[model samples]
Target chain A: MTAGIGAAIVILALPAATAALLSVLPSYRLSAAINVASAFVTLLAAVSLLAAAPQPNAYILVDDLNVVFIVLNTFVGFTASVFSATYIAHEIESGRLTPTHLRFYHAMYQFLLLSMNLALIANNIGLMWVAIELATLTTVLMVGLYRTQEAIEAAWKYFILGSVGIALALFGTILVYMAARPVVGEGVQGMLWTSLIAHVPAFDPALLNLAFVFLLLGYGTKVGLAPLHAWLPDAHAEGPTPISAVLSGLLLNVALYAVLRFKLLLDANAFALAPGPLMATLGLISVVFAAFMLYRRRDVKRMFAYSSIEHMGVIVFAFGIGGPLANFAALLHMAMHSLTKSAIFYTVGQVAQVKGTQQIADIRGLTVTHPLLGWSLVFGVFAIVGLPPMGVFMSEFLIVSSTYERAPWLALLLGFGLLVALGALVLRLQGMAFGAPIGSRAPAKASALPIVAHFALVLIAGVYLPPPIVTWFQHVAQLLR
Target chain B: MKGLDFDVAHLLAGGLVLISFMLLYQNRLYALLNVFALQAVVLSLSVAWQAYVQDANHLYVTAAIAFAFKAVIIPLALHRIIAELGIQRDVENVVGVGPTMLAGLALVALSEVVMLRIASEADVLAQEDLAFALSVVLLGMLMMVVRRNAVSMVVGFMSLENGLILAAAGAKGMPLVVEISVAFSVLVALVVIGVFLFRISERFETVDAHALDRFRGDQR
Candidate 1:
C-alpha cells in the first residue's frame, strides 16, 4: 500500500518539481531535456501503478479505470515533449520565439502535464475541478505565446468560454454534493467520488439529473463538442504545434474521463434519467458538425483540430451505447486516436516547418520535396481515416457494428459522418502530398522517430492485441457498465 | 432556521440577482463596473451571513476574499484599465436595455421554477438560496451575451462566479477547498482578462469584442 502511494506521489510531483526548476533555467536545450526526462520518469511511475493499484483515499486513487488514462497521458506527454524539443528549436532559429519565451513555454508545458495527471488520479471531485482549471489556465497562456493579434484573440476566447464552462461545471459539482449530503452526510466525504457513488442510488434523482446536465455542458466544452467548440479550432490553429498535439491527444481525454466518472454516478441511481441518450446525441452532432467543417479549413492545424472533434464525438457515442463490447471499443478508440492524432500533428509540425506556412494552398508536392515527412503524413491520414490494418479501424469497426445492431438510424448517421470526414481528409492529402511543388523545399530538422514510434504501435495493435491489454480493457469495460 | 436568518439570507441572495439585472441595464463602462462592484458587495454580505449561520469559520475566509478581491481590488483594477484604455465613456450594448431586462426576468422565473421543482426535497432555506443563485448565474450569462465590451464581459463572468460562491456557501458543510479554489480562480481570471483587455485595446484601438470578430478571417 505504501509503495503504491509513493509511486503515485512521485508521478504527481515529478512534473511539478521539473516545472519549478525549468522556469529558472537559462538554457533552452537543457530545459527541453529536463522536460522530456521528467515526463519519462512520470510515465515510469504511472506504469508502476499497474503493479499494485492503491486504495481509494480522500484526494487520490489508482483504479482500473484511471490507470489506463494515466499511462496514456504520461506516454503521450513524454513524446510530445521530445517532439517539442526539436520543434521549439526550429521556432527559435526562425525568431518566432526567444529564449525568454521558451522558458515560460517549457514551464507551462510541465505544469500542464502535472495538472492533467492530477485530474486523472483525483478521487475528490473538487480537486479534479481545480486541477483541470489549472491545466486550462496554462494552455491559455501558451496559446497566446506568439503575442500576435490572432493568437491573443484565440487565447482570450478560449479563456472566457473555458472559464465559463468550468464555472458551470463547479455549480454542477456543488449540486452533486447537495444531492449526496442527505444520503452520505456532509463535509469532505460527500464530495469524494468513492463515497458519492456508493450512496448515489439513495440521492435525489431530479437533482442528480440536473447536475449531470451541467456536467455535460461544462466538461463538454473542454471535450470540444459542437456548439461549445468555438475556441477549439482557433486554439489549435494559433498555438505552437506541440501544444496543439497535447491539447487534442491528452487534455480532451482527461475531460472525457471526468464526464465518464459522473456518468457512472448517475447510472448507479435507478430513477435518474438515462445519461446515455444525451451523450449519444451530443456525440453524433459533434461528429457530423466537425466532419463538414473540415472541408472549408485552409490551415493544416485547424483541419486536424476539427478531426479531433469528430473522433471525440465517435468515442462519446460509443460510450453512450454502454455495453461491454461498446465500452471496450470506446476505450480502445480513445487510446488509438490519441496516438494517431498526435502522430499526425507531429507530421503536420514538420510539414509546416519545412514549407514555412500552415496554409495548404502555399505548400505542395511533399512527396517530391520531403519524402520522409510526406509519406508519414500519408500514413497518418490513412490511419486517421480508419483504413484497414490500423488500430482506429478496428475500434471504429466495433462501434459501427454495435450501433447498427441497436439503432440502425444512428449507425447510418455515424457511418455517413465518418465517410464524409474520410473523403475530406483524402482530398486534402492528395493536394498536400502529390501536387506540383510550390513552397520552400527545405527538409525538416526534427527527428521522425516519434512519429514512426506512434505509427508502429497503432499498426501493431491493429494487427494483434497482446493478451494483457485485452484483459485490462475488458475489466475497465465491465466497470463502465 | 429563524425567520430573521431566512429573511436576511433571502434579502442578500435576492439583492445579488437584482444587482445582476442592474448590471444588464447599465450602458457605460464606468457605470457597469460600479454596478458589478455593488453586486460583489452584496455577494460578500451573503457569504458572511452564511458563514455566521453555518458557523463554518472557513466561509469567513471566503467572505473576506470576496470582499477584498471581488468588491474592492477587481473593480479598482478594472476601473484603472478602463481609464487607461480611454474607453471610460463608451456606451456598449449589443441588445437594448428593455429586451435584456425582460430576458433576465424570464431567466429568473425559469430558474425559480426549475430549482423549486427539482430541489423540492432540500431544506427551505437552501432551496430559496439555490433558486436565487441560479437566477444570478443565468443573468450573468445573459450579461455576457448581450454586452459588446470586453470589460463588461469580464464583469459578467465575475458576477457569474459570485453566484457560484453563493451556492457553495448555502450548501451547508461544503468543503473549504472548493471555496478557496473558487476565489483563487476568480483572481487569476481577473488578472489574465485585464491583461487581454489592454492587449485588445492596443491592437484595435477599441475594447469592443466585435473588433475581435472582425479580426478573425474565418468568420463570415
Candidate 2:
C-alpha cells in the first residue's frame, strides 16, 4: 500500500518537477536528456504499480483499471520524448524551431504528461475534468508552437472547440453532483468516483441519462468523434511530429478513458438508458466516416490522424459491444494502436524531414531512396491496417469476431468500415513505398531505435500473448464491466 | 425566507439567460462584449445568492472570481484588444440576425425540454436554475456558431463559460466549484494571451476567420 502511494506521487511529481526545470534549462541537449530521463522514471514508477496494491484515496486512485492506462501512457511518453529529442534537434538544424521554442516545447511536453497522468489517477471526477482541461491547454500551446499560419489556425480552432466541449462537460458534471447529492449527501462525496459509482444505482436515472449525453458529446469532441472532429486532423497535421505522435498515441486514449468511466456510471444504473447502443452508433459512424476520409487526406500526418479516429472508433465500438471478450479486445487494441501509430509517426516524421515535404503527392518511392525508413514505413502501414502477424490484427480480429457473435449487422457494418480503411491505407502505402524514387534523398540522421522498439513490441504482442499480461487485461476488462 | 431565497436566485439566473439572448443579437463586437459582461455580472450575483442560501462560504470565492475576472477584467482587456486591432467596426453575422435569433430560441426551448425532463427529482430551485443555465449555455454556442470574427467568438466562449459557472453554482454543495472557476479563469487568461500572441490583426491582416481559413495547410 505504501509503495502504491509512492508510485503515484512519483508518477505525478517527476513530470511536474521536470516541467519547471525544463523551462529554465537553457541548454537544449541537457533539457532534452532530462525530459527523456524524467519520462523514463515516470514510466518506471507506473510499472511499479503493477506489483503494488490498489490505493484509493480522496484525490487519487491506483486500481487495476487505471494502472494499465498509466503504464501505457508513461511508456509511450518515454519513447516519444526519446523520439522528440532527435526530431527537435533536426528542426533546430533546419531552422524551423529555435532554442527558445525548444525550451517551451520541453516544458509543455512535461506538463502534458503531468496532466494526463493526473487525469488517469484522479479519483474525483471534477479533478479529472480539470486535469483533462490542463492537458488540452498545454497541447494547444504546443500545437501552435510553430507560429505558422496553419499552426496558429489549427491551435485556435482546437482551443475554441475544446473549450466548448469542456464547458459542456462541466455542466454535465454539475448535474451529476446534483443527482448524487441526496443520496451521497454533499460536498466531496458526490464528486468522488469511488462514492459516485457506489451510490449511482440509487441516484436518479434520468439525471444520469442526461449527464451521459452531455459527457459523451463533451469528451467525444476530445476523442475526435465524427461531426465534432473538425479540429483534430488540422491539429495533428500542423503540430510537431512528436506532439502528433503523442496526440494519437496517448491523448486520444485519455479522453476515451474519461468516456468509459462515465459509461461505467451509466452501466451501474439499472434504470438508465443502456449507453451501449449510443456509443456503438457513434463509434460505427466514426469508423465509416474516417475510413472514407483516409482516401482524401493530402497530407500524411492528417491521413494517419484519420486512421487514429478510425481505430478509436473501433475501440469504442468494442467497448460499446460490452462483453468480456469485447472489452478485452478494446483494451488490447488501444495499446497496440498506440504503439503502432506512434511508430508510424516516427517513420513519417523522418520521411517528411528527409523528403522536405509533407504532401503525399510531392513525394514517392520511399523504398528506393531510404531503405530502412522505407521498410519501416511499410511495416508500420501493414501493422496498422491489421495485416497478419501484428498486434493490431489480433485486437481488430477479436473485436470484429466478438462483435459478430453478438450483433452480426453491427459486425458487418464494422467489417465494411475496416475493409474500407484497409483498402485506403494499402493504396496510400503502395504510392508512398513501392513506386519510383522521388524528391530529395537526404539520409535521416535521427535514431531509428524508437520506431524499431515500438514495432518490435507490436510484433511480439501479435505473435504471442504472455499469459500474465492476458490475465491483467482480463482483470481490467472485468473492472471496466 | 426560503421562498424569497429561491425567488432571488431564480431572478438572477433568468436574467443571465436573458443577457445570453442579448449576446446572440449583437453584430458589433463591443456590444457583444458588454452583453457578455452583463451576463457575467448576473452570474456572479446568482452564485453569491446560492452561497447565501446554502451557506457554502467557498462559493463566495467563485463569485468574486467570476465578477473580477469575467465581468471586469476580461471585457476591458478584450475592448483594448479590439481597439488596437482596429476591428471595432467589424460587423459579424455569419447567419443574419433574424435566423440566428430564431436558432437561439430553438436552442433555449430544446434545453428547457431536455433539462426539465431529466431533472425531475432535483429540487425545484436547482431544476429551474439548471434549465436557465442550459439555455444560456446553448445560446452561447449558437453565438459562436454564427460569429465569424475571433473576438466575437471569444466573447461567445466567455458567455458559455458563464453558463457553466451558473450551473456549477446551482448544483448545491457541488465540490470544486471554486477550483473549477479558477481553472476557467486561467483558461480565459490563456485565450486572451493567445489573441495577443496570434496578433490576429497583423498575421492575417484581419481578425476574420476567413483569413485563417485561407491558410489551412491541408488544402494546399
Candidate 3:
C-alpha cells in the first residue's frame, strides 16, 4: 500500500516539479533534456501502478478505468518530449522561437502533462473539472507562444470556446451534486465518483439526463468533436508542432475519458436515459463531417487535425455501442490512434523543418529528397490510413464488424467516412511523396527513434496480442460497461 | 424566513439576467465594462445572501472573491487595457441592438421553460434561481456571439462565469474549493486576455476580432 501511494505521488508530482525547474532554467537544451527525463520518470511511476494499484481515496483514485489511460498518457508524453527536444532545436535555429519562448514551451509542456495526469487520477468530480480546466489554460498559453497574429487568434478562439465549454460543464457538475444530495446527503461524499455511481440508480433520472447533456457538449468541445471543433485545426496549424502532437495524442483521450466516466454513471442507473444513442449520433456526425473537411485543408497539420476528429468519433461511437466487445475495441482503438497520430506528427514536424513550410502545395518528392524521412512518412501515412498490418486497422476492423451486427446502416456510414478520409490522405500523400522535389533538400536534424519506437509498438500490437495485455483490456472494458 | 430567502434569491438572480441584457446593448466599451461590473456586484450580493441563508461560511469567501475580483479588479483592469490599446470606444455590434434584445428575451423565456420543466421537484427557491441563472448564461453566450470587439467578448465570458457561480451558490452544499477555483480561473483568464489585447493591438492596430478572421481568410 505504501509503495502504491508513493508511485502515485511520484507520477503526479514529478511533472510539476519539472515544470517549475524548466521555467527558471535559462538554457534551452538543458530544459528540454530535463523535460524528457521528467516525463520518463513519470512514465516509470505510471507503469508501477500496474503492479500495485492504489485504493480509491477522497481526492485521487486508481481503478481499472484510469490505469490504462495513465500508462498511455505518460508513455506518449515521454515520447513527445523526446521528439520535442530535437524538433524545438530546429525551430530555434530557424529563428521561429527564441530561447525565452522555448523556456515557456518546455515548462508549459510539463505543466500540461501534470494537469492531464491530475485529471485522470482525480476521484472527486469537481477536482477533475478543475484539473481539466488547468490543462486547457496551459495549452492556451502554449498555443499562443508564437505571438503571431494567427497563433494569437487560434489561441484566443480556443480560450473562448474552451471556457464556455468548461462553464457549462461546471453547471452540469453542480446539477449532479444536487441530484445526489437528496440521497447521498451533503458534503464531499455527495460529489465523489464512487459514491455517485453507487447511488445513481436512486437519483432523479431527469436531472441526470440533463446533466449528461451539458457535460457532453462541454467536454465534447475539448475532445474536438464536430460542431465544437473549430478551434482545433487552427491551433494545430499555428502552434509549435510538438504541442500539436500532445494535443492530438493525449488531450483528446483525456477529455473522452471524462465523458466515458459520466457515461458509466448514466449506464449504471436503470432509470436514467441511455447515453449511448447520443454518443453514437455525435460520433457519426464528426466522422462524416471531418472526412469531408479533410479534402479542403491547405495546411498539412490542419488535415491531420481533422483526421484526429474522425478517429475520436469512431472511438466514441464504439463505446456508445456499449457491449463488452465494442467497449474493448474502443479502448484498443484509443490506444492505437494516440500512438499512430503522434508518430505521424513527429514525421510531419521533420518534413516541415526540412522543407521550411506547412503548405501542402509547396512541398513534393519527399522520397527522392530524404529517403529515411520520406519512407517514415510513407509508413506513418499507411499505418494511420488503416492499412491491413497496422494496429489501427485491427481496431477499426473490430469496431466496424461489431457495429454491423447491431446497426448495419451505421456501420456502412462509418465505413464510407473512413474510405473518404483514406482517399483524401492517399491523394495528399502521393502528391507530397512521389513527385519531383520542389523545396529544400537539406537534411532534417530530427531523432527518428521516437517515431520508430511508436510505429514498432503499433506494428507488434497489430500482428500479435500479448495474453496479459488482452486480459487487462478485457477487465477495463468490463469496468467501462 | 423561507419566503424572504426565496424572494431575495429570485430578485438578485433576476438582476443578473437583466444586467446581462444591458451588457448586450452597450456599444461603448466603457459602458460595457460598467455593466459587467454591475453584474458582478449583483452576483456577489446574491452569493452573500445565499451564504447567509444557508449558513455556509465557505460561501462567504466565494462572495468576497466575487466582490473583490470580478466586481472591482477585472473591470479596472479592462479599463486600463482599453486605454492602453486605444481601442475604439464605440464598437459596432455584429447584430443590431433591437434584434439582439429580441433574441435575449427569447432566450430568457426558453431558459424559464427548460429549467422549470426539468427541475420540477426542486424547492421553489432553487428552481427560480436556476431559471434565472440559465437566462444569465444564455444571454452571456448571446453577447459573445453578437459582439465583435475582443474586450466585449471577454466581458461576455466573465458574465457567463458569473451565472455559473450564482448557480453553484444556490445549489446547497457545493464545496468551497469549486467556488474559489472558479474565481481564480476567471482571474487567470482576465490576465491572459489582457496580455493578448495588447499583443493583438500591437500587431494589427485594432482590437476587432473580425480583423483576426480576415487574417485567417476562412470561416467555419
Candidate that scores best on lDDT = 2
Query: What tens-digit string does per-residue lDDT give for candidate 1 at A1-481?
Result: 8878988998889999999999999999999999989999999999999998778788798899999999999999999999999999989999999999999999999999999999999999988888888888889889989888778878888888898888889889989988998888879999999899889999999999999999999999999999899899989989999999999999999999999999999889999999999999999999999999999877889899999999999999999988999999999999999999999999999999888888877768898889989999999999999998999999999999989999999999999999999999999899999889888877798988899999999999999999999999999999999
Q: Which stretches of candidate 2 lie over 4 Å from their true place?
A: B201-220
Name the docking class for model 2: medium
Candidate 3, residues B20-125, lDDT tens digits: the string is 9889888788988998889989999999999999999888888888888888887897788889778779866879999999999999999999889888777777
**TM-score of every prediction relative to native:** 0.97, 0.98, 0.97
Error of 2 at A255 (Å): 0.4
Q: Which pairs, if any, clash in model 2?
A: none
Candidate 3: chain B TM-score against the reference chain B: 0.87
B194, model 1: CA deviation in Å? 4.5
Candidate 1 clashing pairs, residues 3+ apart or interchain: none
Model 2 chain B: ten consecutive residues of lowest lDDT? B200-209
lDDT of 1 at A86: 91
lDDT of 1 by residue, B74-188 (tens): 8888777777777646656778889999999999999999999999888998999999999999998998888777777778888998898899999989885444446455545
Pitting candidate 1 against candidate 3, the one with the higher lDDT is: 1
lDDT by residue for model 2 (A1-481), tens: 8888998999999999999999999989999999999999999999999999456989898878888899999999999999999888989999999999999999999999999999999999999999999999999999999999789988988998999988888888888898899899978999999999998999899998888899999999999988788889989988999999999999999999999999999999999999999998989999999999898777898899999999999998899999899999999999999999999999999999988888887778998999999999999999999998999999999999999899999999999999999999999889899888889988997889999999999999999989999999998898777
